[model samples]
Target: MKVKVVSLLLFMTGVMTFAQEDLKEREQQAAFDPAYTSYSRKKPAYVTLKDGTKIEGHIKDVDRKKGQIHRLKIIEDGKKKVEIQATDIADLYMAPSGLEQLDKQANFFNDATKWGKTDATKHLSKGYTMYTNQMVSLKNKKKPTEYLMQVVNPKYSQVIQVYSDPFAKQTASIGVGSLKLAGGIAKSYYVKKGEEIVWLTKSNLDEHFDRLFMDSEDFKSKYEGEKFKWSLLGVYILDYTEFALDAQMGEAK
Candidate 1:
C-alpha cells in the first residue's frame, strides 16, 4: 500500500510538470505570433509637432477614442519609446511599405482641421483627416482646389423614432439616438472653394459639378452620358474633374 501511494504521488507530479511546460510554450508562441503581435508592432512613420519639430520613428500604437487620436506611442533610437498627445502633434504620415509601386507612393496623413458649417465662426472641433487633394477647380483660379477630403467625428447626426406601445396603456414614446458604434468616427466629405467650406454629398453632386464646369461642353456631354453609381460616385467625380482639367490644359497649349 505504501509503494502504491508513492507511485501515485510521482505520477501527479509528472502531470503537473507537463501542464506547466505546455502553458509556458503557448505563452512564448503568443509573444512572437503575428496575429497576436501585429497590433503592437511598430510601423515606420514621420511625425510633425505643433511647434514645427519633426520626429521620425516607428509607431507602436495609436489610441483613438471618441473618433479622435488622443495619443500615440512611438519607438525611436532602436530602444527608446515615447508617448505623445494629439494636442502636441501637427500631423503623422505612415510610410507605405508594400511591394506595389503605387502603394509605396501612397501617403496616409493623420492631421487635425476645423471642419463643418458654412459659417467660418461656427466650425466644429478638430477632426481626423482622411484624404486631402485638389480635385475641384474653379474658373480663372490660379491655385488648385485648396483642400478636399473626408473628415471623421465632426458632429453627430441625431435620429428620432416615435412608437406607441399598445400593451402598455397605449403609451407613446420617442427614442432619440445616434450611431453608437461610430465612436464619433462617422465621416463626411468637405470641399473648400474660395473662403467657404461646405459638406459634399451625392444629392448635391450635380449642382457642384455644374457650377465648376459651367463653360465646358465636353465635360457636360461626357458627364451626362455616364450612369453614376452611388457606391462609385466619389471615384467618378474625381475622374471627371481630372478629365476636365486635362482638357482645359490642352486647350491652353
Candidate 2:
C-alpha cells in the first residue's frame, strides 16, 4: 500500500511538471513581437454593406481572380445558415490591436510633452493620428438621411459622446477621424425614444469632457431617441503595421 501511494504521488508530480513546462513553452513561442507594417492592413471579421446592413461571416470564397464577387457564408445557427455574394460590402473592421500595436505599451505615462519622441513626448504615440468613418440610422429622420461621416485625422478621434439618458449623462469616444458632437443648453422636447449620442464632433476635441457641453437646446432632439454606434481605431503612436487596421479574419483562404 505504501508503494502504491508513492507511485500515485509520483504521477501527480509528473503531471504538474508537464503542465508547467507546457506553459513555459507557450510563453517562449509567443516571445517576440510581430512587425507592424504588414499587420495594419488586416481588416476585421465583418463587413458593412452599402445598404447599412452589417454581415458577419466567413469568406468561404472570393473569386476576384475572375469575378469581383466575394461569396461569404454566415452561420446564423447550426442549422440556419446562408451563403451570400458579398460584392456590395462597404467597410471591414478588425478585431483589436496587437502586442506591438502600441508604441509605448505602458499604463501610466510621465510623458506629457504632447507629441514628443521619447518618454517625455506626448500627443499620444504613433501620431495620435486616426482615421474615421461613420454611418447614421435614418429610418424616419430624413429622406436624404442615409448619413455617414468620416475624418482623416487622429487629433479628432477623442471626442465627447453624450446622450439624453436620465441616468448616464456623458461618455468619451475614441473614434477614428470624425464625430458629430454638439455644443450647449439641455433641452426639453417631445420626442420618441432612440437618441444615442448627445454632443457634436469637433467640439469635444477642444474642451475637457466634463466642461464640453453643459446645456444645449438641440441636444435632446439630436440624441435623445437615437442610437449612435461608432468605432475608434488607434491613434497608433508607434510605426505600426497595416494589419493593425485590418485583421484578415473572415477570409477563409
Candidate 3:
C-alpha cells in the first residue's frame, strides 16, 4: 500500500512537470510569432472607393515600398486590370489564404493587440479582411500620406475607426544575456474620426479616450471603474462604439 501511494505521487509530479514544460513552449512560440501577415497573393477582393463606390475583383498584387503599400493592382471581373493608388482606396477586403488564416489564429491566441477577448481577431474569424487606407506620416515622408492599414475595430465603422499600423515594430529585451529583439509588426494603434487620425499610444490614450468618446457615458463609467490600462484601449473603443451606435439609433427612432 505504501509503495502504491508513493508511485501515485511520483506520477502526479511528472504530469505537472510535463504540463509546465508544454505551457512554456507554447508561450515562447507565441512570443516569437509575427502579429500580422502581409497580403500579396491573388484573392477575391472587394474594394470601396473614397467616394462610396464599390469595386469587385481579385487583388492580384499589392506593392509595398518602404513598409507601406505603394500601389494596389486588381483584376476586375477576371479581365480588366485596374491599378489604384493607395490613397484612392477607402476600404479593401480579401479572403484570407490558408497561411494567413493560421497567422490570424496565432495572433488571436497571443492577444497581439492586448484587446482581451474583444480584439480585431473576431472580425478575421468571421471572414472580414479589415484592411483600409489611412493618412499616416511615414518616417521618410514630409507630409502625412495614405497607406494600407488594418482596421482593428471594423464594427465601429460609424463612430470611429481604429487601425493597426502594419509597419509598426516593437523591441523587447529578453534572456539572461539581455538580447534585444525587434521586428514585431502592428505594435501601434491609430484612431480615425472625421478628418483627423490620431495615434493611440500609452502616453495619449487616457487623454484622448474621453475627448473622442464623450458621447458614450456608459463606456466612460466602465473605463473609470476598471482604471483602464493601455492594453484595454481596444476594448474601450469597441464598447464606446456600441454605446454610440445605440444612441444614434435611438435618436433616429
Candidate 4:
C-alpha cells in the first residue's frame, strides 16, 4: 500500500513537470510566430464593415502574415461564431483585454519612457487598440496594397491618423552611398490625412510637415522656437491634433 501511494505521487509530479515544460516550449515558439500576435483569450470588439454594417462580438482569433492581419475569428452574441476577412472590415476597435493589459504591464516594466508612447494611455477605457483599412506599400514592393493597419494614435484620427508600419524593412545605409543592408527587425511609421497616406521618415518629413501642421499656429510657434527631435514626431503630431480639435470646438461653440 505504501509503495503504491508513493508511485502515484511520483506519476503526478512527472505529469505536472511535462505539462509545464510543454507550455513553456509552446510560448517560446509563439513569440516568433506572427499569427501569435492575436490574443488567445477572446476580447470584446466592435467591427465596422465597408457597407456600414456594425458587428459587436468578442474577437477569438486572428490570422496575420508578414505583419498584416488577413483574417479574424469572432464570437458574436456569445453563440454564433463568425470568421471575417480583413478586406471586408473597414475598422475595428478592441476593448481592453488580457492581452492589452499584459502589454501595458510589460511596457511599464521594460521602459518608463515608453509608457505614453501613444495617447492610448489616456483613453484606455475607450479602446485599447484600433485598426483601420489603409493603402500601404510594403518594402521592396512598387505597388501599394490594401491592408489592415494598426492605429498608433487615435485621439484625433479625424484630422490625421498615425499608423505603425508593420511591413517596414529592417534596412540601414551601409556606407556614404545609398547602399543599404538588411538587419534585425525595425519599425517605421505612417501618417494619413484624408485619402493620402505616406510613409514618414526624417528625410521626407520636411516636405509634409508644413502642410500637415499649417493650420496649427501652436505647432508652428513650437516647431520654430524649440529644437524638435525626430524621435518625438508622434508627440508633435498629437500636439497639432489637439490644436486642431480646439479650433473645431471653438468654431462649434
- Distance from true position, residue 135, model 3, in Å? 2.7
Per-residue lDDT of candidate 2, residues 99-210 (tens digit): 1333333322333332224321232243321111222322224232212121222221123212121111233422211222222221211111123322233333223222
What lDDT, from 0 to 1, does candidate 3 have? Answer: 0.61
Any idea what lDDT model 1 has?
Answer: 0.39
Query: Is 1 or 4 the stronger prediction by TM-score?
Result: 4
- Candidate 3: list runs displaced more than 4 Å: 1-35, 40-42, 51-53, 77-80, 99-126, 138-142, 170-186
Question: Which should have the higher TM-score, number 2 or number 3?
Answer: 3
lDDT of 3 by residue, 1-253 (tens): 9999999999999999997776454333322223245553655677878898888787777787646665888888857889998888887776655433332322334442233344334445655567778777654244887787766555445567776655565534342112123343234667777777877666666677667776567876755655755544545555566577567667878
**Ranking, TM-score, top scorer first:** 3, 4, 1, 2
lDDT of each: 0.39, 0.30, 0.61, 0.61
Better of 1 and 2 by lDDT: 1
Could you tell me which 10 consecutive residues in candidate 3 have the lowest summed lDDT? 176-185
Poorly placed runs, candidate 4 (over 4 Å): 1-36, 78-80, 95-97, 100-127, 139-141, 167-187
Per-residue lDDT tens digits of candidate 1, residues 34-89?
00112213345566677888776877776653223457788876668899876676
Tens-digit lDDT track for model 4 on 185-217?
223567787677888766567777777776677
Model 1: CA > 4 A from native: 1-40, 50-52, 78-80, 85-90, 95-218, 225-227, 244-253
The C-alpha TM-scores of every prediction are 0.38, 0.21, 0.61, 0.61
Error of 1 at 92 (Å): 2.2
